[model samples]
Target: MNIQITPLTEDTIPGFHHVLEEIVREQKYLPITEAPPLDTLRTQLLEQLRHHLQHFVAMVDGVVVGWIDIKPKLSLPYRHVGTLGMGVLPAWRNQGLGQALVQLALKAAAELGLNRIELQVFEDNAPAIAFYQKLGFEIEGKFRRHARVGEQYRDALGMARLLEIAH
Candidate 1:
């Protein structure tokens, strides 16, 4: 399969949402079981674009199959930090897509003057935890029963990676 990693564009928003919904419906990786409304997602994406944030998508033969995004904190004290979110379609997992996407985001964050990147992953997702660890992320804390999807209660591990910013 031919895979290309590129910045998300306005035209690709629908494709990105499709991949996101597919992953969310699986009830495995992300906290939400459903994708947000399309218009809402579009507005959010537009805002990210407006701010020139780090939002990227992996396209296979021109179709979005996975995405990774980092949004900096809005508060003055936390503006130097960014929160990361990523998802790869089940079929696209196990390949190097996730690593590539995240690495690019990390580099961009450092260039954007971010001092740290943070993420929260469900504890049951061992592969994701291991992946983050391999990428130099450390588990800072755990949120007990952080998420409840229906009758299932899941614990979340807060992980972060520090970036070195050049003067």
Candidate 2:
């Protein structure tokens, strides 16, 4: 399959939304159990774009199958850091789409002058943990019972990588 990776843009919004909804419905990962309303989703996307948040999308034969985003921590003390999120269509999960999306995000982070990037994953998601580890992220900490999944609180592992930016 021909795969292309590109920055998130207005033209790709529908495909991005479709991938997110599929992931959310799968309910095997992500904290979200349901997709947001289209209007709300559009508003949030606009806000992210307006603020210079970095987002990348994986396109398989012209269709978006995955996405990755890293939003800068805007407060004074953490502006150099970016918190990341990513999702891949279930059929494309093991095809390197996730890796491509992440590497693209990291490059964007470095380009944007971000020194550190991180993400939190549900503790039980071993495949995702391994994927992040392979991408040079290290587990920095674990939060106990940090998020609610249905009726139970689940632990989350925080992973981060310090990026070397080109001057």
Candidate 3:
């Protein structure tokens, strides 16, 4: 399949949301098991873009198959850091799409003047943990019983990567 990674725009929101909904309903990853309203999602995406948050999407044959985003802290003390979020469709999981997205995020973080990027992944998700490790992220801490899904609690690992940027 032909895959392309590009910065997300308003035109791509619908397709991006479709992939997110499918991935969320899989109930295997991500905190949101259900997608929010379309307009709301679109507005969120646009708002993020307006605020120096960078978002990129991986499209396979014109359909969004994965996405990565980073939101930088704005305060003086924490402005050098950014938080990351990303996912790939089930069918696209093992084919390097996720890694590619992370690479893009790292570059975007540097462009945004962020010196470090961090992420949180559900600890029970072993593959995700390993994947983040492979991408130069190190586990910094664990959020025990971070969230309740039904009766059980899920733990998340806080991982981060330090970037060398030319200031």
Clashes (N, CA, C under 3 Å) per candidate: 0, 0, 0
CA lDDT, candidate 3, residue 149: 66
Off by over 4 Å in 3: none
What global local distance difference test value does model 2 have? 0.89
lDDT of 3: 0.89
Which wins on lDDT, candidate 1 or candidate 2?
Answer: 1
Query: What residue pairs clash in candidate 1, if any at all?
Result: none
Error of 1 at 135 (Å): 0.4
List the candidate 2 regions with Cα displacement exceeding 4 Å. 165-167
Backbone clashes, candidate 3: 0
lDDT winner among the candidates? 1
Alpha-carbon local distance difference test for all models: 0.92, 0.89, 0.89
Candidate 1 clash total?
Answer: 0
Q: With candidate 3 superimposed using the best TM-score fit, by how many Å does residue 103's alpha carbon deviate from the native?
A: 0.7
Query: On residues 17-116, what C-alpha lDDT tens digit does candidate 1 reach at each position?
Result: 9999998998878889799998999998998777757899999999999999999887889999999999898898998999999999999888888989
Candidate 3: clashing pairs of residues: none
What does candidate 3 score on TM?
A: 0.96
